[model samples]
Structures are given as C-alpha cells and as structure tokens.
Target: MALDRLPAYVRKLRNAAGEPVYYWELPAWARPVKDEKTGAMVPAMRNGKPMLLASEKLGSDLAEVHRKAQLLNAALTDWRKGAEGASMVPGSVEWLFQWYRKQARFTSKKAKTRADYGKLMDMLAARETKKGAPPFGKRRAADVDAAAADRLYEMLRADTGPRQASYAMQVCRLVWSWATRHYKVTGVKENPFMGMGLTSTAAKGNRATSRAEYTAYRAKAVEMGFQSMATAAALCFEGCQRVSDAFGYVDPDAPDRAAIVWEGYQPGVEITLVQSKTGNPVTLPLFEEVPGEGGGVERVPLYPELEEELARSREATRSATGPIVVEERSGNRYVERRMSNVHRRICDAAGLPKDMTFTGFRHGGITEIGDAGEDDVRPVSGHKTLAVTRIYNKANAEKARRIAGARRRHIAAIGALDEARTK
Candidate 1:
C-alpha cells in the first residue's frame, strides 16, 4: 500500500540496520496512559520503539493490514473513553475489589493463584442484578446483608455449580472481612458473607483404592509401558504421601537431595522427607515385619513390590537422581495434572470405579494402617493432627463393628465367670 493511503499517525521509518519498520505514533494531544492488562504505560516510544504494525510483516495482505489498523484505532479510542468515565464509587463491590487487590492477603498469593481468583472476580463482575440490570459488582457493599449474600451464593451455585460457588464465596468473604476491619466506610458493620452457609456439593467421600484395584492398576500400567504411573501409585501407597509430594523432585545435585532420595536397601531403614502441602517432616519406613503366631522367625520389612516399581522407574530414566515419575515417551517430569491424567487412564483400564483417584491410594493406605490399629502410619502420612489422619480413615465402620463384637465377647466371658463363681 502507498504511504498516503495509510491512516493518520501510521508511518514507515528506517531502523539503524536500514530496514523498513512501521509503527503508530499517538496524537500529540494524547498523553501516556496505563494499559490495565499489562500495567504498562502505552504509546511507548522509548528507544524509538513503539507498538509495531502487524501489517508491515504481512507484506501484500491488504485485508489483514486494514484489520490491524482498525483494532489499534479502536483500542486507543476505548482507552481514551475509559479515562473519561466515572471513577469507582466508594463502598461499592468494585471499589472493594480494587482495594482488596492491593492488600497483602491478595497480593501475597502466587501468580497462578491470583490469576485463578481473577477469573472468579470476572464472573462476579459480569453477574447482573437480574437479567439485564446493572452488574452486582456495581452494587454498594453495605447493601449486602446475610439474605443478599445467600441469594448471591444461590445464584452462583445454580450458574456454576457448588465448587465454584464455594470458592467465589470464600473470596468474597476474605474481601468483606478485610473491608469490615480496614475500610472506615459508614453503614458497614459486619461482613454479610462471614457466616453465610455455602456448602460444597462436591463429593465429600473419596473412594479408597482397594488392594485388588491397586494390583490391577499397576499391572495395566506396566503392560501399557507407563512405569511412571505405577511408580507414582507405589510412592503414594507405600510412603503414605500426597501425589504432589510423591512425585516431587529437586535437583539431584542440590543439598536437599537427602530429603527426596531413597538410600541403600537397608531392611529397617526409612526415607525422610517433608510433606509438600503441610510442610510437616515425615519418615516413611521402607518395610514392615510382624512376628508369626508360631514365633518361627522375624519377618523383614522389605517392600519388594514398591522396590520393583522404583527400580523400573530408575531404569527407565537411567538416572540415579531426579523425579521418579516422568513421561514415558519424553522422559520429562510429570506435573500434577499430567500425572492425574495418567492415573485416570490407568484406572479406566483397571476397571476401577470412577471415584477412585490417585489420591485414593494415599487415603487407602492410611486407612488400611488405621484399620490395623497402627498409629505409626501418622508419621508416614505427615498429618498435622490425629484428627486429620482420622478424616482419611475410611475403615471406621469396620473398626466399629470389630469393637462391638469384642465388647459382646468380653461381656459373655464376664457373665460365665460370675455364673461359675455362684455355682
């Protein structure tokens, strides 16, 4: 296209290398403005560098050039219009969100966490009073009472389902709490979301993987050449660890190698590491030997099944160090989601219930130990409290039945003794 045919402020210039470059120059009347998406000053002209026109690279694509020019013009116009719009009203939900974003509670979160929360905030911002009314975010914060909070939660639940509704409610509760404590806005007494009853409809019960399920899943994984999945299952089951901690890795050469590495094959030895989620230090015994009833010999605690899986993984990676669970094809370390997908696939092949997840291995192992009346599993599970461990104990019903049977037998024995003494 000819230079005269291009829009105003669209000019071609020569670089230091004498190559042609095209960029848009903001009008002299327009001042530097902040771009909300990037938090950067726009109309960037430093070092003779500004927003490059895609059309310049497209060559003879006149249609693409026109589209790019239109988009750039529209963006500039929108920025100018937004700058002239009304400012956020104090005590409004929008104002509170802006203030909350600056607080340590929100700012201290990880980038991914903040991004996830931002999606929920966007959802809340789009929610209208009814169907075509103003957005809920524009409503005054003080106008939200307990009933209003409940209604909003109900709406969110109906729209997005319980998990997202619960999560959104949690974010709102945090902001409302911060506002109640910090913001001195009048008519704002207590946080309406504080005591709002928002329960998750997500399944409360996690199906524990049975011994049969574990065996079947492992066999299927090995048959499919997914040794990493088998290794992950063993790690969670034997170590009583969460999937994240089970698959966690650090540089093999790092000083923290001891925390993740399993040393030599000593029978009574244990592997020590800190739990990734709870940060609680845990020592998992490598073996468990129990004395036979006949007192023949002491059993060795060597976990041959787990050892085999670990050895298989090590052979696959050809490394003495690094993450045990990895992609079979690329030998890349597995992220949590990727590992979960592998687990799901394995479960499908094993014909296991849909509710059985990778996490169930940890819960099942812990529950099995609990069923055996062994409190030592707590050290391996790395639960902060016995209560937390009990929560994972799905063998409570069986334990209760066993206890009841034992009580009945003891009562009968006492009655027999009393009758014998009377005779």
Candidate 2:
C-alpha cells in the first residue's frame, strides 16, 4: 500500500471549558488537535512525523481566549466523536465577515451603501495603521480587531442624520450573525463580533449639547475674525437658525425687507429664513416675552446692520427671487464666500473651544425654549411634545411639596416655643 497508515488527523486535547487533557493517540480522520501553548493546532506531515502548526491569531491577548476555545470545542465535539454534526476550525471569524460584506454589496437596496462600505473600509484601514508603525495601506479587514472597531464607531457619532450610526452597525453585524448560523459546515461556529458589546466598541454615543455652551460659542465665532461671522452670530441669536442653516447671507429669494417671512412657527418670534434641513416653516411673532400680558406679538423686524445686509442682498439679486441676503451684484446664485468668511472670523476672534461646532446653535435654542416656562409654555416655544418642551422645565413637584410641608411644621414649633416663654 502507498500509505502505511492514513495521516494522523487532529483532535483537540481541550474540553468544553477549555481545560487541557493528555492525548497519547488520536484517529487519522481528525483534523484539529490543540497543544497548550498554541490553543488550537493544525497538523502537517513532515519527514515521517506529524507536527502541529501555531501562530498568534489574535495579535493581542484575548482575555477570554480560553472561553472561546471551550465554546469552539464543545460545538464541534460531535464531529470529533464521529457523530453526524458540523465541524470546527480556527480563524473562521474572518471568513464570516468576508462572506457578509460580499452579500451586503449584492443585496443592499440603497445606492449609497457600496460607497458607505468603501468609506468604512478606508477608515478601518487608516485606524489600524495609526495603531502600529505599519504602512497605512497594509491594514486589511482580516487584521481588524475589537480595538479598531471601537474607534470606527467614535468617528461616526457626530453624523447629523438620526440613527444613521445605529443602522450602519446593524448592516455589518447582521452579516456576521448569518455567517455563524449558516456557513459552519464543519461544526465550527464563527462569530467574530461575539462579546463585542463587552468592549467599548458597541457603546452608543452621546448626541445632546446644552444651551449655555452654545451661547458662549456665538461670542467665540465673532472673535474668530470670520468676515460675516459677527452677522451670522447675530442671525443665530435673533434668527435661531442652525449655523449651517444660518448662512448669514440671506437666500436670494427672500424679500428686500428685513421681515423676510417664513412658515416656521417658533411660538411668537418670526424666523427670517427657512431651515433647509427639516423644511419646517416657522413664524416666531416678534415680541419680548412680556410675562403678564401673554407676551405681545408684532411684525418681525431687524436691527439696522441686519436690515442693511438684507437690503444689499435685494439690490444684488433684483433680477431673482425675494428675501435675498448678501449676493454678488453680477451672479444669479448666492455664493457662500461672504458667509464662510464671516463664520471663520467669529470663531478665530472669540477663541471658542475646539469642540463647539456650528450645530451647537440648535442645542442652545432648545435650552432657551426650556427656560421660558413649564405649565403652559407651549404658546411661547411651539414645542409639539412635552419631552421636547420640558427639557427646560427642571421643576420637581415632590421636592416643592416637601419644602412647603417643612416650612409649616417649623412655624408651628416656633409658635409653641413662644407661648412657653411668655408663661
């Protein structure tokens, strides 16, 4: 016979708990035999000897490597016992992810999905490169670890669209799960993202920013010496538009008057421009919050310089639509040059903190609305929901009642003490 004995196959010397046991001899059909140092072993025939191959699969210490070994072995024990079940193998995590990414590329309905994955892959590569001294391009998907995935999430936290980050993770995660359930023909369950939640990589990020910081940021923007920053800041405060929405230079379509009306109903104050993002038209009637008289309302008017800017926009775009602000005398379009110039000026001049971005304006507005009142502040802020309106209402009903009760008891005790003294 060409072969004296069929090649000696591998049998894991570990149990479901990953406790190692001695093995004097194993069947030739077995494929996975583990040694203590290597954890899982692959066998190769050399010079009439069966040797085990080992390598650093994690590239770092996996705190639960033993646990994973246990799980892998337990799941594949039937195959090792010659029972009709799936098998287990090493380095199957990569296979699962690769298969998932391929399926995602095929079945994704959104046109932007492929592009999104492309960006994610690039980001993952760049992040891994930064960790080690390796060349940037050398970091591949197979090499990504939990540490790298954690960083990828942090970068995507600031996206403006709600739940985009959550949805993106779901796409990749679903694929990983599918691989584990379907692809393990050899009884080797491969789920790389298992226990991912235990790591910081799977944590949800904070999105809310308070109002006080946003107000200060306005001053900082002016200090930044941006050409139109001062005006944009004024727009943010008076107009209550997000920085991106606040393009200090008004839309060319706005009417010449500072009272460029919009459909947004911000309680009593009229907004001069439409918010491009939500397209929620509002009209905040002009009036100081006149506490007793239900806050008087009047036509939306602008301060002199703001009025002048609006006028200039009209003069430039007389050929176009109304409510136009700061436009080139020659062009039909409203170039953002003046607006961008002013924004930078304000930020540099104010020396604002690095963390404050243009979006913080909206956060500030939310806080301001909260400060106005609670019982029925709906008219002033136009908050459609109590949660939306009550952000400012920090009043605790239980605490207030307790304070009142304590005051009454103190008064009664004082009166009794005074009678005793008189007697």
Q: How does each model score on TM-score?
A: 0.58, 0.38
Look at candidate 1 and give me any clashing residue pairs: 287-301, 288-301
**Tens-digit lDDT string for candidate 1 (1-423):** 553477655666767888655566666646455544323344433322232212223233444444455445543443344322254466777667656766789878865466567567645744654753556766888888888888889888888888889999898888788788875753466888887766684657777886567778889999988988887787777666786666663222232422344442333455455475666555444543457788866544434567778778778778665555666765555544456677788778878888888889888777666654565454556666423354444353233334323333443565687899999
* Candidate closest to the true structure, highest lDDT: 1
Pick the TM-score winner: 1
Model 1 CA deviation exceeding 4 Å by range: 1-95, 108-116, 138-148, 185-190, 199-202, 223-225, 249-259, 262-301, 328-333, 383-423
Clashes of 2: 48
The local distance difference test score of model 2 is: 0.38
Worst 10 residues of 2 by lDDT: 52-61
Cα-based lDDT for every prediction = 0.62, 0.38
